[model samples]
Target: MKQLFYFGLAQAKACIFPIIIFLTLAVTKIIDIPFLHRYDLILLVCIITQMLMLALKLETMDELKVIGVFHLIGLALEIYKVHMGSWSYPEEAFTKFLGVPLYSGFMYASVASYMCQAWRRLDLKLVKWPPTWIVMFLSAAIYFNFYTHHFILDFRWLLKLLTIILFYHTFVYFTVRKRTYAKPLSLSFILIGFFIWVAENIATFLGAWSYPNQQRQWEIVHFGKVSSWLLLVIVSFLIVAMLKHLKQTKGNLH
Candidate 1:
């Protein structure tokens, strides 16, 4: 029970950036900022928050690099997804481009932030991690499938199954206070994906962005999106894991 409390506390700490972003989304939905567009203001808030965290030593430079990579990757994906008519930034903003608000990328960056923070706060390490080639192949497939599925047949479920098989023996070891606990890496992906799905619903409800169906009226996001989030979480985890592996092993990206 005590360990569980500590684990939850660490999780909350890790989620600081995501929580702040959600709050900003909710507040900006109602609050009028006459001086600036809402999306621009959101972009500004995200920038300021990141700078403050850096100055306060709340986030390490390495983590910032990770967040930066995720930001660009996310923004690129967003640009394409919007172009493909997946979803949209319905409101106006000077910072908007290719139909995506600049701040929208931070939504993905926030997930990377949580992963980075949790890795440190929980003293996380991987066990029985897959080989570098297999991991990289899977990561590439999972990421590309996000875009390919829009044009071709959706291979997400098959990819998910492959992910499970590859990482079935893998585990993440994390410390909760003085005690240590281990969880299957695959299960961790599903749980984080679930929570991100919850956050997505909150973001949509707060008017961060609207799905096609929600554009007319607010509605619960489809459960199918959970699969997308699952793959996304896996991608995010793999990126961070590879970085950690490189740093820790000084070469192997396993």
Candidate 2:
């Protein structure tokens, strides 16, 4: 019980970025700014918060780079998904390009930030991590399927199956203070994805974005979206893992 209490505290500390974002979302939804549009306000808040986090040394430079990549990757997908009518940013904002508010990317960045922060705080390690080639190949397939599935057949289920097969044997070792713990890598993906899905529900409820059904009336987001988040979480984890490996490799060469 003591270890579990400490574990929760560590997780909360790692979630600082995401917590701030969520609070901003909720607060901005209810409060009105005189001139600034809500979407623009969100964009501004995300930028300033990121800068503050870096200046304070709360987030390392290397992790900032990873967060930046997630931002771009997320924006691209948001642009494409908006074009395809997957969902929308209905609020008006000068920061919007192609109907996606720039802040949307930050929401994705929060996920990467969480993973990176948790990695640092928990002293995470991988056991029996797959070879670089396989990991890279699988990550590419997961991301590609996210795009191609819109046009071609939806291969999400198959990709999910692949994720299970690829990561089932792998384990994540993490320290909650002095007590170390291990769990299947796949299970971590599912857990993070599940929490992201929960966060998504809250975001939508607070008018962050709206689905087709939500546009007409507030409704529960489809449970199927959990699978989508699961796959996305996998892509995020793989990218972080690869970047960490590269950094370590460089450090060793020094």
Candidate 3:
């Protein structure tokens, strides 16, 4: 039974790369197909099912507690942001469970699990504290400046900013040790992320994925695009680096 579970896990992991490639091709219109939304929904369902299987096999009860807490925190932040108009979701895509969509909770839980995985892979002790601090600072600036629609009032913005800072600090506190065995920050990942962000923003502007509250001056919202580029670069690099580290570590163990 244990072997079967692991075998399934391996198969699922193998599928991820192809799934990403397929999605990317479809999104870019290189595939020239309809039913994009249906495919997206299928992907989401698959991801949720995969996470459930992982929960049953990989995570402990205590880890589940942490995941639950992070999910709640992320959901709250998303709700607050959406209510303030930072980013609006399509009503068709979400279920309003607590005046917020069920998808928000799912996103939160997924992010928490992902971050935990990253935390386990990198050893932060080798990296200087400055870069980590700067990353947190950038996270704050990005959250407050670009995502400000989540807080229309200055006071509310400040509160949200504080919450973001607290979350960043908490995440860092838990994940810092992994930073020690840092690998070279991959430029390829950063470039790919930047291009993806740019493409998404362009699609958004073209009404492919709407950002209802993004305001333009002179019919151009370059600032948002730039910030998106930055966010994606940082996020993608971190995620890829961690995944690579995990792969290498596992190979070493084998």
Candidate 4:
């Protein structure tokens, strides 16, 4: 227990800069600034910060491993999506720091940080049924995201589909192999993914973020406005669930 606490403290020390960068961006309205103006520079800064933190080796090796996997997954997906034109950022956000997407690595780091907290607090159990759920949820998510804004479709979809399948299998293999999480966490990711698609679709339909060139007509779904919020809640709960379990376990150990 002491080891875990100390490790966390060390990680925090290592991550101070990246955390500060994110906070500064969030609070300073820099992130919200026009993508054409400063998005690229900001993303470049992010890439640098993450690289530095990763090289520091301040966190647990296990956490880094999971995060590396997530980073690769995010990288692959981002490239595939960009090629497909499913979604894209403005010119300023563009940066191929490592021959792939820049934002993905940042996302990977965040995911790793979140999962590390759970890993410390919980030893997950792997169950067979979760794979089935993963597949189903992914299918629903793809459909939802595509049906919404046509971000994922056409020739690229074939590749995207394959990529999603591969991602799911990889997750299954690692989560099951390491027993880092149980069915609940799997369900959480799947559900959240689906909700994101649905919410994104709703946003497109309502003209929240338009794809002017696509000229795609949205088939009206329901209020749809809440879909994104629903996703956020679910994903947040999943992380919390794992952390809550870990906290309880830590208390018992003490």
Show the colliding residue pairs in model 4: 40-92, 86-151, 121-246
Model 4: ten consecutive residues of lowest lDDT: 169-178
In candidate 1, where is summed lDDT lowest over 10 consecutive residues? 245-254
lDDT sort, best first: 1, 2, 4, 3
Q: What TM-score does candidate 4 get on C-alpha atoms?
A: 0.41
- Per-prediction TM-score, please? 0.97, 0.98, 0.42, 0.41
Per-residue CA lDDT of model 1 for 67-160, tens digit only, reads 9999999999999999988898899999999899999999999999999999999999999989978898999999999899877998999999
lDDT score, candidate 2, position 58: 86
Badly placed stretches (over 4 Å) of model 2 are none
The sequence of per-residue lDDT tens digits that candidate 4 reaches over residues 119-226 is 343443333322434444544454345334554343334534443444443332123223333343334455545644564454345333234343465454444434
RMSD of each candidate? Answer: 1.8, 0.9, 10.9, 11.4
**Ranking, TM-score, top scorer first:** 2, 1, 3, 4
The superposed Cα distance between candidate 1 and the true structure at residue 210, in angstroms, equals 0.7
- Cα lDDT tens digits for candidate 3, 31-136: 4335444335534653565466466655445445555764565567667766666555443433454345554454435444443443443222223222445455
Best candidate (score: TM-score): 2
lDDT of each: 0.92, 0.92, 0.44, 0.46
Over 1-254, each residue of candidate 2 has an lDDT whose tens digit, in order, gives 99999888989988988898889999998899989999999989999999999999989999999999999999999999989889988888989998999999999999999999899999999988888888899888988887998779988899889888888899999998778999999999989999999999999999999998999877988999999999999999999999998788799999
